[model samples]
Target: MTLSCFDLGERMLSVAEAQRHLAGLVGEPLAIEACPLAELSGRVLAEAVHSPIDVPQNTNAAMDGIALAWPQPVAALALVGRVLAGGRFDRPLAAGEAVTITTGAPLPKGADTVIMQEQLAFPGAGQVQVSRPETVRRGQHVRRAGEDVARGSLALAAGTRLGAAQLGLLASLGLTGARVHRRPRVAIFSSGDEVTAPGAPLSAAGIYDANRYSLRGLLQALGCRVIDLGILPDDRETIIGALRQAAQDADMVITSGGVSVGQADWIKAALAEVGELGFWRIAMRPGRPLACGWLGEGRTPFFGLPGNPVAVMVTFLQFVQPVLRRLMGQPEWQPRRLTALAAEPLASRVGRVDYLRGTYHSDREGRLWVRPTGRQGSGILTSMVLADCLIEVDADRQGVAEGEPVTLQLLNDFS
Candidate 1:
């Protein structure tokens, strides 16, 4: 059955709603693979990791110092012996005796504090004098075994995204490899007869296909394995065939354009013929005509984005990214938003949420200021290229005035 634009918009899910829906649909667990620590970057851990042993392995000096009992006064004491890292001191330090130890060196028997070398004055006759007050405390400047990570403790939780710090933690736990969820396989394409490949001569109405490349890069940044299906023309038959092929191999299929109610829009019909039509016409500007559904007997999900460049990008980031994160078994899969003052006035209609591309900066007072990139038209891809963030105007709000505080969604980290 054909779904009306308002009906689709009303049924259109919020970002969180879409994520939950997709998670329910894809309830099956993702396949986990054992990957070397080096290759596990950006992958989600599939199993909880426990530390086999304690970090530091033993009590060691935190700095180069004389290992001695605390409460020792500024009296000359015999320099008994020296202990370096990885060396054991079999002899116990008696009263009026001190042991020289370096940073990370194991504490000798009877030594309870580390006195920094600079705090002591060494005389010619194998003795030293400490002028500081009784400042040294027992067990000062020492790292105890298992203080960081105890054996059998949870080192990393399942579904944790393995980043640089996570990798280092795994290494410290003596883990050479990790079991991580397989990267989601996504197929991306752009539709429209007027869309031509870059570097080619443009016809009177043809424009370069930026959405395909842009979406591909976005998917890659999300750690998905992307299959580029290239650009499909506006023809219904060709679009359906390309989508069918993509659905057969991909976990999710994504395309831009030809989903609206216009006469030339054939993506809606093509999607219906191949799969169950879910929803279209989201309550969003530059992306209201977005469509989402499932394809194939297996119900592989698909996204039909608007033809306009800005619409394609905004819709993908707001909608499709979270679903991909769920498919990869990521625990927290939400974009962060921050409030910033509008640098200038922005005009908008009240029915749809508007994502205006803009540059964000911090003033001397540390207040965030956002200025929209000129030309808020959905067709203008250049605006997005120049923008660092998308200033979000709520669906019920008409517009924002200069110096008014509004929420800003970051597209990329500038710092």
Candidate 2:
């Protein structure tokens, strides 16, 4: 089970090294487009956006209160004018003068303090008594100009993913649209004579193709424009032709199955004939056979993944996801991992990194715990549906005991 004991008899690349190689191969961001703010959610910014005007625009009341000028021995003040939101008192306040202002109403000139309406008593029609004058501090309850955002300052930087708060801020700045990088275009397919589509008549040896659909979902979740080419026939000409077409149209071409060095595998051969290809034996369980290269004259990136259902998912999340984000101009995207206590012992090899499907939960004391979701077989697609995360055992670790801390990659919480 160790690296030296591997049957492949060659030095396999660690997950980190393989990731670095893939990262270095991806090209720059695609073209940028001016996208409307209403449709900019999940888009990556291509350029920094600056504020045209100050947020809140002017000094205003932060709460409903009586705006007044506070003197040393504050006494009774006369309510000269009433100001609600969107209404402003024109004239400046004189000594012992006060104005009733609602939340977000502009503070009148010479008004430095505001006392809550509850703290003041309207003794007469025009007279207001301040019982807690000492509680009213200078410049209290006043929102200063440029407090939230100053004019001509950077509001959002490039590569920032637009979300609810970001869009709200842009809307406040009076911007209807923003410049963003185009979404990455992806083409996916599965190759194998045994793989067939669901709802079709199946023989005893035929298995429904699940990798393409799951890959489509994963790509869509990553905001990719996925073109599903379906299952390719197990023929050299058909595989080569499909790969060429995919490379010409997509930013990244991915195929599941036919990546291993078996007699029937044609993915590596097709890649070699159509473009540059490298078959790698990565030191990772469930997903060890991987093919990485470029295709067509434009050099579209290509990835060949294993045939196992779980292997396709693991390889995509760990390898292809980062490359796609980089091509989309997203700089902050990375795999999220957290350390949690293992609820049960798990056996693993020393040379290979293991991603075990697990159900993770938080106890009443807020401690996180994880346990395996039944079988850890690569073809058990149902196990993934029952697990929330993948417990990642490092390449150097042989096994994990109960209560031992282990790093788990969160799979369900995409946001």
Please name the candidate that would achieve the greatest TM-score relative to the true structure: 2
lDDT of each candidate versus the true structure: 0.81, 0.88
**What's every prediction's RMSD, in angstroms?**
3.2, 3.8
Task: Please provide, for model 2 over 310-329, each residue's C-alpha lDDT reduced to its tens digit, 9 standing for 90 to 100.
Answer: 99999988998888888878
Clash pairs detected, candidate 2: none
Number of clashes in every candidate structure?
0, 0
Worst 10 residues of 1 by lDDT: 1-10
lDDT of 1 by residue, 1-415 (tens): 1223225454654544444454554555468899998898888888999999999788789999788877765378788888999997898888888888999898887888888888888876778777674675688888888899999999999878787889999999888999989988999888888989999999999989988888888888778899998888778888888878888999999988888888888888898778877665466677877677778887787888888888888988887876777788764667779999999998876766788999999999999999999998998888999998988888677889899999998996311
Which one wins on lDDT?
2
* Candidate 1 global lDDT: 0.81
RMSD of 1: 3.2
Which 10 successive residues of model 2 have the least lDDT summed?
Answer: 1-10
